[model samples]
Target: MKLKFLGKRISGILAILPERELHFDDEIGNFNFSSSNSLKLKKIMGYGRHRLADDDTCISDLCIFGLKYLFDAHLLDKAEIDALVVVTQTPDYLIPPTSNIIQGKLGLKHDLLCLDINQGCAGYLVGLIEAFLLLGNEAFNKIVLLNADVLSRKVSKQDRNSYPLIGDAASITIIERDSVERGIFANLQTDGSRGEALSIPAGGMRMPASDSTAVLELDGDNLRSKNHLKMDGGAVFNFMQTEVPPMIEDLLNYAKAGKDDVDYFLFHQPNKFMLQKLTNKIGVSPEKLPSNIVENFGNASSVTIPLNITFNLGQKLKDQSYAVCLAGFGSGLTWSSMFLRMGELDFCKIVEFVNKGD
Candidate 1:
């Protein structure tokens, strides 16, 4: 799908990362690989420390904490918010949407719209798209788009493929009308035929969680249960390399933009290797496309895009505007990209999630 939106711009961004940092070396022995092989994987995949929410922390916790920070800073006014949109693969519950949970916890107005979108990897782009759409309604003025995931809690600690790179994070983005009337161009594609390329096989309705699903069995070279995140690494890599560059080309063409017109390509961070390869195929310089998020903070699912911005370009974004391209691809076999003028925000920073009373 191709989408175009006008008169909508993001005013602020706040990314909250878990305080708990687990280093790759500390957990190297947990993987089923020789030390030399594990070290090789780390060097190749850009494995470093990843943030994982403590057992007690939930998706709602991060969102509430980040939202309150904005509220307290006066960067955002609760009363001015017309909608709350949360995009996450990990919800606090199967019922009572996390958006509603956040609104109620903060005691926001009843007239506001609260919606939850189930998406992954491409979530930041997905969330922005949904936020833009919601702004089309005359009733909505300000929308808070929250992209969060605590998928470390979903993956098996014994699984070498995903454990070292899984991270937890939440981003609070404030989007509202732009007086300048700039156009935001975007495109989204999904291939459910290859959905299993990245999925958790036994958590939802089709196959409810059970003892059988929880049994650890050998999956390739790793031991993982059906309840854990399952990824066909090779398949996903091939899919991204084959699909993303063309999708980005189409998006740039649709927006009548040349590659040089973009100041930065803020893409989802799956790993350092994949991003560099994608950047090569896209014919952009490595400096224009950052791939260090995995090495610094691991891949926090959809939050990676916002996390990338806040972590790498927060200072610049706070005072200057830039023409940027954003892309996120993963789970759902989904790939999405957006071209927009973003920056000059009220706030753009990352805060560590500190527990209350700690």
Candidate 2:
């Protein structure tokens, strides 16, 4: 199942930071409450409606803005896009799905195929696989895959443990069928038995919204006491150590490549510590790995992978095979990894104009 990497194109790309920044507190009422016994600040990141210039706008609005920018960049002259796939867990609405909203806002033709995948961090890789499968049929020529999530919206502000780590952002990628050789070698896996390693417990069919369902208490800092993100940090670390490296090895073997063949390793941007551990365990040198945006952008869920490719990788390496191993393990305890060969594009031109402030 070889697909030519016929030059992929990206359109709209935008990121915004919220006004309020939340930091981690170690002391609770003159007593050390933090596990580390030290107070450190984590950025509580989000983009409000004020930033969008419309109070009625939600996080999805920022996504819309990014999507429009991509369409314009592609220079499509009023052409109707064939398909729209939105990979997001924190969608704008629960019932109608965010893809439908995006489709309407973009004024895509009625015949457009629109859907949403609720695969959390692994969503982008899985979504890309779906898009590739659909586009590979030779029937559809162009497809738009959008990965956007405002994770800060769901984060519990009062949960000092999680409040400082989550951030929000959106990204859009336009995929088309071409004869170039830079798509994907699908290698995906999951373990539902250990699913709750990381997750948001409320606000789903399993536990729908209700008054008696206990309103999440908000502390003085505007952080929620009850609705915060929960994770067994140690358990997750253990799982990562055991699962990620071998998967990478297997994927490389399946793709007919090796650790030394990859131009750079772009795994899920979990955090600095986790990334370091994974890299060391996998025997990948620091220079060969992409920069982790956790410090500034935090975990953008599905957008992390694309953001790395767009902002970090850019056009630095050309004609090099990039082994992009996307491992998303959290919430449902689901994880998936896929290797893709990224060909060189004229990123210098794109960056020159963007940097020149044009």
Candidate 3:
């Protein structure tokens, strides 16, 4: 369960994105209809700063800012990174993938291996595992994994049930083979059958764009047309309650650690209610759960877990034997959990001495 760390390192992590303050009133409750009918209703409650056009700093830009900040903080030489991976379901463009866009903006070498993953929520963990494997070969040294998803663009603002809950954001974490921690212990899961429960019905190869399709309407905060995110909320919740706890337990067992041994539980920030439900079912104390950013950012899709970790680094995580469990469940109805042992920065010694009035 222990990994050798001659030099394996987590160079840095950064979350760079604006806070989305979405609001809604109880009047939305009046539209209680069947799932199909509900899908057509304008459900999104509200949005913060909606006037900023799509071209103004997209999720990709936020991701790049995070990566750049991490690289600068770690003082990494530009020539050292050998590979880059970007994970997202909402890429900036459909043609060249966000990874290529990031590579070009960052000025990374064209020869450096670059790729994109079309995973939904589990994308970050899957991308991290891939980065670790590439580093483990010793052929590649430093690797950057960037995750960003702008779900707001796809969410039908007209749908009161879903519009108020989706947000946009991005995060980046750099992984190296020989630094601070082992990063991830493998125990990832997927359920393709349930994929239909959480997905966008159109805009893919199966349902390509067509002139016959009606022009999607944006009604206030809700989407008033055909193109919109569809979800069977009850089914998704059932899946999470039944499947996630056992998967996490198994992952901890494989790591040779108990639930109590874990210092922090960082689940995908779907919402405060969902997080609380999962924590109670898993029997983990409320204090052990990481504070979610969903209140301010809603659900940032794949970027949630990493952003939560980065934002809370210095506050709740000082010199602790931290066990980080990341669980991402969304779209593809896909879910994954990875365990890692994290050591906090050594700042206590300085704080202790300085506080003595010396």
Candidate 4:
């Protein structure tokens, strides 16, 4: 899908991360990799450490915490929010959407618009698009777009290929129709035939959880079951390289912008090595590209994009302006890229989680 929307601006972004963190060294007992090999993987995969929620925590907990912080900080008011949209694969429940739950928890007006979208990785771009469309409605002035995922709970600790790379995070982005005429130029692509490249195959209505799905067995040197997250690393890497570069080039052309015009290229940090390769292919300088979110935060799914904003551009966003090109690719075999100018944020920061959610 190729599209564009005008009059949408990002007022602020707040990303919340769990307090409990896991380091690569801690995975020795969970995986079969040798010490030397584990160190090599850590450097190549950009696995410095990743924050994870406690066993009882859910994606909503982090999101609600961040949203409340934003509200309390006076960066935004819950009363002014006319719409709430949450994009997550791991909702609090299988029935009532997390967005609906959030609306009730926040005590927003009952007439508010609440929607939950199930997407991964590309969800940030998808949410931005949704926000812009909702802003078109005069009745809906302020919109909160939330993107989060707790994929750590979906993977087996024994699966080194997927476990160490997954992290948990949530972000609250306030979007409103701005006076500036600047808009978003975006292109989205997907290939469901390759959905198995990254997926959790069970626990959905299509394949309800059963004893067979719960049976953990050897997958190469690692162990996983239908319920655990799975990824064909090689296939996902190939997909990224094959589909991403051209998409970026086309997006730049669509917006009539050059590499030099973009101040920062904030992309989904799948890993450092892959992003370095993609940056080289795109001919964008390393200074203009930040690919190290996975180094400290791991891959927090769609939350990775906003996580990048708060981590890398937090200070810049406070007093400067920037034109950014954001991209996300992975689960759902989905890929998306957007060209937009954003800065002068009312708020931009991250908060560490505590026991409040419990």
Candidate 5:
């Protein structure tokens, strides 16, 4: 799908990360592989340390904490939020939408709109698209887009494929209508046939979580239960190499712009190696695409894009405007990209989620 939005912009962004940090070396013994092979994997994948929320923390907790920080700082006003949009695969509960939970907890206005979208890696772009669409209504002005995930609890610690690099994070992006009449162009594609490449086999209504579903079993070289995150790394990598470059080309062509025209490519940080390969395939400079999120903060699903911006270009983006391309691909077999003029934020920063007691 091709999309174009005018007179909408992101005014600010905030990423909230857990205070607890875990190093790759510390978790080597948790994997079945030898120390030598584990070290090799770390070196190749750029594994360092990642933040994980504590056992009791949920996505709502992270969002609420971040929102409170903004509110307390006077960067955001409660009455000004026209809508609350949360994009996550790890909602606090299956029945009650997490957006509503956040709104209720924060005592936000009853007239505000609350929506929850079940999406992963490409969630930031998805959330932004929805936010921009919401601003089309003349009555709406400011929208809060929260992209988060707490998948550390869903993945098996014994599973080397995902555990060491799993991080939990939430990003709050403030979007509002702009009078400047700027254009935001984007494209999205999905292949449901390939959805199983990255999914948790059991959890939803089709297969409820049971004792049998929670039994850890050998999945090739790793151990994980049906409730754990299952990833066909090779399939996903191949999909990215094959599908993303063309998508970027199509989007650029549709927008009548070339790759060089984009000042930065803020993409999802699955890991360093995969991002490097995609950058090469897309014919862009490595410096333009940042891949350090996984090493420093892990892959926070849809939150990676916003986290990347706040981590890598926070200070620069606060006052400067740039033509940027944002892309995310994974989980749901979805790939989406957007090109827009962004920056001059009211604020951009990351805050540690301090525990209530600590």
Candidate 6:
């Protein structure tokens, strides 16, 4: 779908990661590969290290921590928050939405709308669209768009193809109405036929977790149990190579924006190899497109977009105006992108969980 945003701005973006860092050398024994194979992966997948949450941590915990940091820093006000939208595949519970849990913890207004969207890579784009649309209501002036997931727990330890590539993270983006009008343009799409290319086979209504779900199988390079995350790496690569470039082209054309017109192109940090391929295929210069987020933070799903904002252009975004093209692909067989320019954000930084539960 093509989208347009009016009277809206991404005022700030904050990302938090669990402080526990895992180095490749320490995790070499966990994978099913030889040292040489692992080294190759490190070089190709940008897998020197990635962070993981404590066994006791949750996505809401990370997101709440980030919100508190922003509030403490006076970057945002909890009382003024009109809505909370948390996009995650690993919510705290299937019953009450994680957004509600966060709303209560943060002590925001009772009337604040809370929604949970179970999405992955394409999540941030969709979350931003939701925030912009909510601004259509005259009553709602600010919305917290939280995109996060503890994906490490969903991947099996023995899965060499995926376990090493997954990382845990949460990002909080504050969107609000600004007098200076800058419309956010977007294009979101889904191809369900290719959904199975990346999925968790169990723990859902169709296939509840059971003894069968715990059974591990050697499915291609993915040696994961039915309960673990699965992926047809080749299929995902092919889709990125063929479909993603055109999607970007369509988004730019629909928005009447050019690749050169964009100051930065931030994309989901799937891996170094695929990013390189996409950069070449899409004809985006390496200087304007950055793909090292996975090398430092891992493929943090939707959080990667904000992570990129803070990681590569955090200070710049906080100090000046620049056109940005944000894209998220992989998982959901979905891909989406948006174009916008932001300046002088209230907050743009990454935090480590210093006090785990806090």
Report the C-alpha lDDT of model 1 over 1-358, residue by residue, as the tens digit. Answer: 9999999999999999999899999998888889899998898899998998998898899999999898898898999999999999999999999999999999999999999999999989989999999889899899999999999998999999999999999999999999988999999999889999999999899999999999999977798999999999999999999999999999999999999999999999999889889999999999899888988888899999999999889989989999999999998889999999999999999999997732
Candidate 6: stretches off by over 4 Å = 356-358
Alpha-carbon shift of residue 203 in model 1 (angstroms): 1.8
C-alpha lDDT score of every prediction, in listed order: 0.93, 0.60, 0.65, 0.89, 0.92, 0.87
Report the C-alpha lDDT of model 2 over 13-72, residue by residue, as the tens digit: 334333333333322332224434323322222211111112233545756665554456
Ordered from best to worst lDDT, the candidate numbers read 1, 5, 4, 6, 3, 2
As for model 5, its CA RMSD to the true structure in angstroms is 1.0
Residue by residue across 1-358, what tens digits does model 3's lDDT show?
2222234545455555653233444324433344455333323212222111143445566666655655575545567778878888878888887888888888888778888888877787787777877776767988878787777777665566466566676666677765444545656777788898877777788886565444665444344444567767779888888988888888878777788877788778666666778888899887778645665556677877866676565443445546677777777767788777654532111000011111
Candidate 5 lDDT for residue 78: 95
Candidate 1 ranges beyond 4 A from true positions: none
Which stretch of 10 consecutive residues in model 1 shows the poorest summed lDDT? 349-358
What does the lDDT come to for candidate 3? 0.65
TM-scores, one per candidate: 0.99, 0.79, 0.80, 0.98, 0.98, 0.97
On TM-score, who's better, 2 or 3? Answer: 3
Worst 10 residues of 3 by lDDT: 348-357
Cα lDDT, model 2, residue 231: 63
